[model samples]
Target: MKKYFRSGEIFIWFTGMGLGLSLIMITGLLFLIVVNGKDYFWASELVQITRTDGSKQLGEIVKEEPIPNLNLPDSLWNKGLMRMQMKIGNRDLYGFDFQWIDEREIKNTDLPKFASTIERIEFGNFYGFVKEILVDGDVKVKGEEEIAKKIGSYLDITSSIRNEIKDIEKSKIGKINYNIESLRLEIKKIEFRDKNSVKNKNEIARLESEIAKENRKYEMLKMKVDSLNLLASRYAVYCEDANGRGKTIPMINIVRVYQPNNMSFLEKLGFTLTKIREFIFDDPRESNTEGGVFPAIFGTVMMVLLMSIFTVPFGVLAALYLREYAKQGPLVRTVRIAVNNLAGVPSIVFGVFGLGFFIYFIGGTIDQLFFPERLPSPTWGTGGILWASLTLALLTMPVVIVATEEALTQIPRGMREAALALGATKWQVVRRVILPAATPGILTGLILAMARAAGEVAPLMITGVVKLAPSLPFDSYFPFFHLDRKFMHLGFHIYDVGFQSPNIEAAMPMVYTTTLLLILIVVLLNITAMIIRANLRKKYKSATF
Candidate 1:
């Protein structure tokens, strides 16, 4: 036997081992997802309806158990149907016979009951059991869009409609008072004519008749006001209610919602499938429920969007000035140093700056000058999406500036000289030749900025990281982006679930799920950038430095 260690063989071997380890880790992740969350994909929670006698008992069927020896030989087995009785009031709701068959068992016969007075019966599957109970509610679950529309409708119709009705009632009461006053005058006028005369009696009767009519009108007006008030109250309640189906424990309903599929479905779709069903679709019972991640997601995305919209154009322009036009002076040198230093500032410092400058000072000025109606309560003068985005953009400015400058520096002097040599203007040379060549680098920088923004939790926490967002930032409504409204983030979700949740046991799985989802999103974004970079490289291969 001969042993030969070729050049770079050790490095290659190490690389291979590293890759194998990564694959093993990924496979382990997939296995966990399959074992825990696969059934959650195909299986929608089934609402167990237990209606016996005149009463209805509504609750989630948390779990089902099976009776032992129910599958034994016919001679040994108890000769009775093994039906699980659900206690719904005074009556028993039994599971349908032979419907709960295990795959391992061949027999489809009646199961044994422990007693005929039967308060309990076991229901189980032979292979394994499902721990996640089905949740049901009295009302049908709605999606984000539907819920937003409903919320907007309530805000629109209820508030204005109720106000109008209230005004109408007030007017009607005034009219009634006017009528009563007129009748009082009429009685006073008839007082001198006679104590019991026929003319006086007729006048008194006519006045009484007028007063009775006014009273009826007033009652009708009151009823109308009350009805409007009740409607307005209900709408407000529904807008706030997470699980609005019923008062009972959520009835597990087999709901079909478009959700973000986990790794398995993504694999099946060639890693292209972006969305799959999740428990988040279920109406949330509380702010911490899986259904409630909407707020955090919304907030996080909004913050990032706001940051990008502000940073990119501004950062690019500033970089262009420093690279293309600005004279080499102490002032320019100082500015460059400042920009570089800004990148190194702790993110928490930006959070503090945002709290003071964006949230309070600038926002307060805006609140005072423009939005007088929303004043005192401080519209812009609050920790909101707008300030958070602005703050993060300011924090990320140096990164963009540095990346753009480096990209510009890499552009060969020959490229610019050639463009000028062709009689092209300086602006044309920069725009057509320089910037286009640097687009990929610029995009790469932007992608890096986005990744950083997505993972940022500290600055956001101080600025506007809300646990639950009432609405999404961008919506179908006018000005669709509601920067004032609070939003959600995956980073924050992991933090809150892992640290803030009271029931760590229950929230542990959710923390994993959320962490996994965040990783998937970041990976997808980076992959997209890689694709873009590859395309750019192909297009500009000959235009080298």
Candidate 2:
């Protein structure tokens, strides 16, 4: 024990135990999030259709019966239909329906144990007029036979037409193949002769002429194929109509519902993973069926990119000035103190400053200069992508500056002295020698800044974040990116779903999943930055002082 104490192994053991405990705590938090949140990632089906107008209800499509499940104790089930309601935007939304059926309140109650199970549930748009009934009962579903018959007819007609087109395509392909074989024989004969021979030239020219003729035939066949493809796409889309009518049926205005099993953590985690995959790859807009997270993902990436672009150069330069050029004086001391103090400032304070200065003063003037008609509604003056990025950059500036300066300080003074002694220019020395050695430190700062900026919700909430973005920042349009637009962020999504949502039961899963997603994104960004830093360190290891 005395030897171990003298060698400081006891300190090492204690430190290691503390670090291990911290890691376990972090892992436990992540595990809880993964298990709780993954369910809401799946696209839920629309079951109950609630109409707008505060009037009659439209019919509900009960895909599956509701399974008897309860998470609460029996005391909570004594009251009648208890519902949680909330005001979202301009609408009053009703969430899960909690029923309290007491045996003492009712007489001769014989509730069936083997009732139909509800596989999934969704609430449709309450903003549209729904004329049908919207309640779940033990009656058989209507419109099956008529819809099936119409669908069968449409499929039969389209199939026959598609088959005929395919046969014609096959015939054209066969002809093209035969011509290719003939051309190959001519090429083989030409190859057998000497390159300088007149016989080889004659054979090559003849084969070329035949190939040109075949090309013309191929072009004609391709034109036919294009026309047939257009027809096939139209036919396929038409056949997908649930009612089998070609009339454009705008999707039933409905919110998605999923009948979740009270499954274990592992099953829920698997389900969540599947949902995330669907959200990423599947284009739900094709049928206007389900919403995906693509826009949100795009916005998050674009915002981070914009923030990094603005912050990195400015932050690095600021650090360079303070660390290298600026003499240590009262001004320098004051600046250092201010920079350190800035790091402790509440992020929301920066949000307000950004709103007033960048959004109002600078952006307002620009909007007035260019867009006179849009004076009141400031284009870049109001909450926007550019302003949000700028705000986050400013908020995270202190971290970058402090980190970079510390990195610059770590370089031995001898290195700089050697550069100056060798008659190298100051700019050249900094660019070639100092910057290379400091790359790792700069990247560490960048990763920290990125992590902080990505996780921040308050500043973005007031700046430019939206619950549902109208469009992504980037698209294949003029200007490519719309800077003057609000965007959805994973962090904000979590807040909106958890705190603001009326349906706690429904939103809980989404909250956890979005939180997990945000964590994953930050981790990935840090990992990428670390990899680049490591590569730079390897490349310039000899430059270290």
Candidate 3:
């Protein structure tokens, strides 16, 4: 034992044990998340239950658990009794989406082959039998089998028409409105500047003419959309629950309808894949309880990239200056200490600073000078992606500076002398040799910054992040990148769904899924950085020689 202690073997064993325990804990957490969220996409077969009270329930069996504190002689807490959670998702009819029932009261339970699960636009889900397909308030197809056969293909067609209506409303009409707003702003500016001369009036007339044309186009689009909506509303699916409760859902409102009990393994697998795609690619709906999180993903990745763009060059330059050019003195030492201390400051403090300095001071000034026409109603004098990125950049820069300084320090004095002896200037030596050798180290700092930035929520919430953004920062609009736009974030989404949502139980699956996605993204980012660092390390093994 003495020998092992003296040789540090005991410490090594302890360290190894600690690392192993940490890895196990991480794996366990990931497994838990995966298990809980994966069930959200996998189509569970619908089960119909007949209770002792003669009531019938048809829905997915969410889970079952043993009774707590079971008493052998007591009927309420009987030894073998248990309870089950059922996602009886007909919220409009039931006023709730889930139920808990004592297993002892269940008389009989069986998989219902004809039971259909309808994913609707609102009111959660409908689990029942498709009784009729009605068009123009007339029965187009009646009976369960006939409706299933005829309505199968038309639902998909309805979805396409839904997309067309969305494009016409949001994309095309939205652009026209945007253009009209810009023209109005221009007119406002001209009037405010007292430049309403003949030429300006002619310009204004032209602008008004353009606005008139846009209005006419908008009216036409609105008419077309109304007609499409009318056509869509004409078709509806009449469904009945196990207990004979009936509801008519419009074809346009139904996302999908499937008989999960009848689906084969391959069909379920395909269904799972389709759901995964939608989760990754679709915009969230129902206050982010349903649909996809594509917008949040886009915002997160874009913000981190923007933060990196602002962080790397400035961080590297500051580090280089501190290590290579700045005089060694008390002031320099103080700055280094301050930089190190900055990392420990509360993140929300940075958010406050960002809100005050970036948004109010800088953005407000810009809006005043460049966008006076849009005064009071700010273009940039508010929370936005640019300010959010800069705020995070400020928050994470110290790590880069410290890491980069350490990387620069690792290069031997002999290398500097050798470069100098070969007639290389200080700048050339740094640019050519030191930078290449320190590339791996710089990337290490970057990975740390990115991981921290990616998960950060507090600063982002006050700075720019929103629960749901109306539009993404990037589009085909002029200048393409709308840095001044508020955007959604995965971290914020997690916070919202987990805590802020009205129905946390229903939001649980989404919370887990978003959390897992965030972890996956962070891991992928780190892996890419590490891979780059490894290659760079290999290439510059001997000080860029």
Q: Considering every candidate listed, which one attains the maximal lDDT? A: 3
TM-score for every candidate vs. truth?
Answer: 0.56, 0.63, 0.97
Residue 388: error of model 1 in Å?
1.5
Angstrom error at residue 386, model 2: 0.4
What would the C-alpha RMSD of candidate 1 be, to one decimal place? 16.9
- The TM-score of candidate 2 is 0.63
TM-score leaderboard ranking: 3, 2, 1
Q: Output the better candidate (1/3) by TM-score.
A: 3
| Tens-digit lDDT track of model 3 for 1-545 | 78878999889999999999999999999999998898779998999999999999999888898878543346555465788999999989998889998877899999978899999988878999998898889998987777767787779778888999999978999999999998899888887787658988888888889999999999999999999998888889889999999899999999999899989999999999999999999999888998999999999999999999999999999999999999999999999999999999999999999999999999999999999988889989899999999999999999999999988988888888999999999999999888988888899899999999999999998999999999999999989999999999999999999999877788889999999999999999889999999999999887643
Alpha-carbon error at 214 in model 1, in Å?
A: 25
lDDT (0 to 1) per candidate: 0.60, 0.63, 0.92
Give the per-residue lDDT of model 2 (tens digit) for 1-545: 89889999899999999999999999999999987754345322222222233222111221223223373357755344322221111022333332223223222212111111111113422211111111122112224333323433444554565556656665665567557766865575456445468878787788888888888888887788777655544432111111111221111221221222223456556666766785664322311123355666677778888999999889899999998999989999999999999999999999999889888888888877765544464668788889999999999999889999988998888899999999999998889888889989999899999999988889998889987775577654457678998887777766776787665543555567667878888899899999999998888777663
Best model number under TM-score? 3
Give the residue spans of candidate 2 off by over 4 A. Answer: 1-9, 41-95, 98-274, 281-290
Clashes of each: 22, 16, 0
Candidate 1 lDDT over 1-545, as tens digits, reads 12435566777889999999999999898677555433222321222232233222222122345546656566756544333322211111223212332223322222111001100111211111111221121233354444423433434554476447746854566557756866765675566446499878987998889888888988888888777665544431211111122211111111111212212444445312221433443223333633335555556656776788899888899999998999989999999999989988999999999999988899899987876544466767887888889988998888888888888888899999999999999999988999888877777777888888888889988887777665466665556667776567789878887789754433554676666667677777668877997798678767843
For every candidate, C-alpha RMSD to the true structure in Å: 16.9, 16.1, 1.7
